[model samples]
Target: MTHTTKNDPVRAGLDRRGFLRRAGLLAGAGTVLPLLGAAAGPTASAAGTADGDPDQLFQAGEFAAAGRIYARQLHRDPGNAHAAGQLGYIDLLSNRFTRAEHLLGRAQRLAPDDMTVRRRLADCFVRQDLLARAAPLLPAAQAEQLASVDGTPYAVDGPQATRVPFLDVDPLPQVRGAVNGGAPATFVLDTGAMGLTLTTDAAQEAGLAPVSSTAVTINGRTVTTYLGVVRTLRLGEFELHNVPVSWTDGSIMAFPDGTVTAGTLGTALFYHFLTTIDYRGRALVLRRKTPAQQRAFRAEAARTALRPQPLWLAGDHLPCTPGMLGGYGPRVAVIDSGTLDCGLNTSAANAERAGIPVDWDHPIPVNGGTATVYPATAARMSIGAAVAHDVPGTVGPTPWEGLTGFDLLGNFTHDFFKPFAVTFDYTAMHLFVG
Candidate 1:
């Protein structure tokens, strides 16, 4: 099955809207990773276990911690140019261009040929849309990605259900469905998923003939992908039409850990109905939401024990909720069952404030590159009374200064999400972490 390229698959005469994501990086398979382009832009040499090691704090999204460590390093050794340069780097990520220029300039004078200082300052200038400023600082090849466009969005709709789609969670939480009205197929119920993704094998089995192809990068190689519609996708009593889909030769955002389903029923489809994931009872509920019912549901949602948090819509229009990091950040975190542990995808500054221990020896592997994320355990994470102790997690990067607090909300695969029922109402822009 070959998919020829369609000029622009997104805007090709379908109902479309933007689905926003708060974090800059795409999360890894059951792991959190920054939606960062490459590690070539800027970096610094590592110091001791508890200092402003860019790889450790910067990549772990612990900007707050990195800032503190750098400040301490500077206080001890006022003339440490390395500390000054790193501080300048923080300013750059935070969009404080003037200050970044000042600090990096001083550090540059101190160490005339520091590539790290040069590249960071360049990236900072690029963020401000000042090509001339960045031109002198950046290499020709590196500048292109600095100006890349945003990812594409999709439109998803289904027939009004005569009966609500409620079924047992089957321990693994997979429900039987069909692709293009073919034989029954398996799909994992995942709220953290960005969209309904299908593997090439599954797409072929379903006779998902590709109409157009889109080129994307993975593992540093450009791969051509097909985009088409799943004309008649069935899930229980519901029928979905013209659901935009992508095929994968490699693993994608993937279904849960153990089972290999045909595809995932992620947020794209979830937006159309009232959804509930009941972990204790092992049940999944889906019902159409009428205007009056939506209003009533939202009013009742306020009363649920599940702590209600503000879920922002990403460029993709997915829900992002506020969550605390080690009891410190009531900040942005995407609720991803796809990610492992409560991975910290924020900045070093926010991470240091959380007081979580940093694992300096290892770097977490992202899609094509790597991040300096330290493994950490927790005292307790406050997801509004639903807390998990000693949770397995990673601290990631805080590429921008302004993004210090936002990180991925703890992944739902953790035992904590197993007790109570959870609900995410896209219309209401609210998530119930009950």
Candidate 2:
């Protein structure tokens, strides 16, 4: 959430007393129950109702709005560790390392027992490529592993730019990839993932051994995964060395043509360059994030009439942008290229608030099971400078919000990006499409 925007009216419309009441900060009467811990103030709701309360908004995937409210609460109560920590988390999501350090440090000082805050602080350091700074806050085993790679983590050696031509483009973007000089296998370019992810079959085929193990949630199910490092990864014309990777027992996907997708190349790998998933061009472009390269890209964009839209690196790697649902005010939205079926996916409350009626009588099929998801047409929708009317989408629970710390109003899927040649400028935190 930003301090200023065209949607500032939504923030202005909320008076102090009403905001406090909705936030459950007022006296007993009309008090709403807190969603999580009592000390952290109010949080969320059940399935059907949509509350404008900050906590409810946070739980309902309206993170930008919730963040604005949290900022206000922090302004009023400087000692509120919960508020500070939440702001810090938002900063971490935005890739504002210094701001996250300050806020999380203050929150840690106020509530020393907050492990979540501490972990988030460590994550901030890790994202900045400072393993030494993050070591002390991590567990002994993880710290030791980080210390081992303190000298050179994710070392890269290649040209300034490389293009990985798509091998399969039906369900998602796939390319031929290899690990540690292993045989080439089909891999997905999934932006939803953090680092490199591999299936157990692929890991075995590539002869990788586990360095550590951790629990992760995939498709609403928790699964155990083994972490390892790739001595070298071959993707198109580039080579990345000393890269951390994780392997799980789960199968990502199998193409109808009987091609097995072995793994994924995620943000941790692409953040080193100005990456572009050119669906129209049928290739993944990786350009070095150098001053000359950025200047050349800007010049090309101007020549081609491509508009650059501001984006935030949220959570581990989600590219979030300000967007509107139907006619509702702008909120945080993630551009997730991984979602294949729908152009847009959102929460029921947000859909209802935006004047799109949810058809609870008819449910839709999802990956795990059937859900209260239905097809609907948004009268008006927008993300950054891109706008559309009568857009098709799906409205449901949106379980992925948990992965992103409930910091999104919806997800614009690969279908939404298929028409353009999209470029992600990580350095400037901007997205350009043509």
Candidate 3:
């Protein structure tokens, strides 16, 4: 497909939203890496082995252990900028915004030229609702993202706990919502995406006006994107106000019946609520993250025989967990809600390590490129007590390997955990499956 361009400010073509639909970047294919994958982002550097080095452990997705080592290093050598930065990164992943801000700020002062540290600090400021302080350090597009939500960030306007029944969508979950009082439109619950994104038609129907504009490079191809604010978004019994949104002037993905999804509800909205994608119950539940609510959830989980596993949020909104694929232990597993069709996706290096074969001669088209994808079965895949045997998945080269020099062993899709009710407790940094 040829890339499309547009002249209208609010109708830019092939932005991140369009890129996602075309490249399947969030579907574990890794055709084009995340926004964090640009020139020498935080996780792009490597130091040593996980045996004693914090950098290696951090790259290995062993965040807890890496934090301990980095803390010790920082204590012994107070000027250790790398140690401070790594600790800050860990805290950011764990959602300790204030602590992360302090550590990252210190790291930036020590190593002013480290673009990675500066980027992480900017992100920390944004997370703390200090957009003005972060805007200068961000790129044009991301800076515009903050500006869109400058005065009025996302806020809930109704009851604390709201339940929205999922519309009948296969593989991925969808719900009916309206933007700025426009007609109701369908939105997918895409944890793989960072923020809310709408199609051109949806934005136009809502009468959205562009507030910011910039160009972003995807797979070495530049695409123009515009930012706007969604004054109100109605979902079920609740509503969200002043949400930042980006859209493409062109159409997104088309279904078999010639229908198209309106938009996507990503992590940006879910971060404000204790989100639960109740697959078994056929609903999306959102609750305030209060201590009382946490206690109630713990009691309920105990009664339901659901085990809590550690989950960390990495670059942007990527939710990562520790899991095993085949015989490999402690591999980084991403719980990608955007991925459908397959249960798990593993890198070609990991497949070879697990003794899975690949037919390189037969390449399949992906993200406007050819990839040698092969099907294989893992003897067992486990995340905490939740384990599946004889799991079928795919193997191919992934951009993640090039980004971190670490092979990502598992990318778990929504269908893989469809039988359980999954809850992401960001406040507690835990994922519970029942």
Specify the highest-lDDT model's number.
3
Q: RMSD for each model, in Å, please?
A: 12.6, 11.6, 5.2
Residue-level lDDT of model 1, residues 212-244, one tens digit each, is 443434333444555455666677667665555
Q: Write the per-residue lDDT of candidate 2 for residues 1-434, one digit (tens) a residue.
A: 00110111111111111211122111110010101111212222213223346666665555577678777777877987877887787777667778889998998898887766767777688777787988787654355456556246667678888899998665778888888899898887766656576776877877887665544332344445555677888887888777777655443445444555777676767777889989888899988789988999999988977788767775445677767886686777877666544567787788878897656666665433424467776777776566666666788766444445654678776667676677888788788866
In order, what lDDT does every prediction score? 0.51, 0.64, 0.67
* Candidate number with the higher lDDT (2 or 3): 3
Looking at model 3, the pairs that clash are none
Task: Report RMSD for candidate 1.
Answer: 12.6
TM-score each candidate.
0.57, 0.77, 0.86
Better of 1 and 3 by lDDT: 3
Badly placed stretches (over 4 Å) of model 1 are 1-173, 250-258, 295-307, 341-348, 398-416
Tens digit per residue, CA lDDT, model 3, 1-434: 12222222111111222335452223221111113323334533435444487776776777789889888878877888888988988898878998898999999888887777887788677655677888777655556656667465777788768889988545478889989988888887867666678777787889988766544443445554556788889988788888877764453644434447887787767776788988889898988778887888889889978888887776656677778775677677777666555566677777777665555565544434323456666666777777776665666654433322233666776656676678899888898876
Which model is ahead, 1 or 2, in terms of lDDT? 2
Ranking by TM-score: 3, 2, 1
Query: What TM-score would you give candidate 2 relative to the actual structure?
Result: 0.77
Q: Which rank order by lDDT, best down to worst?
A: 3, 2, 1
Candidate that scores best on TM-score: 3
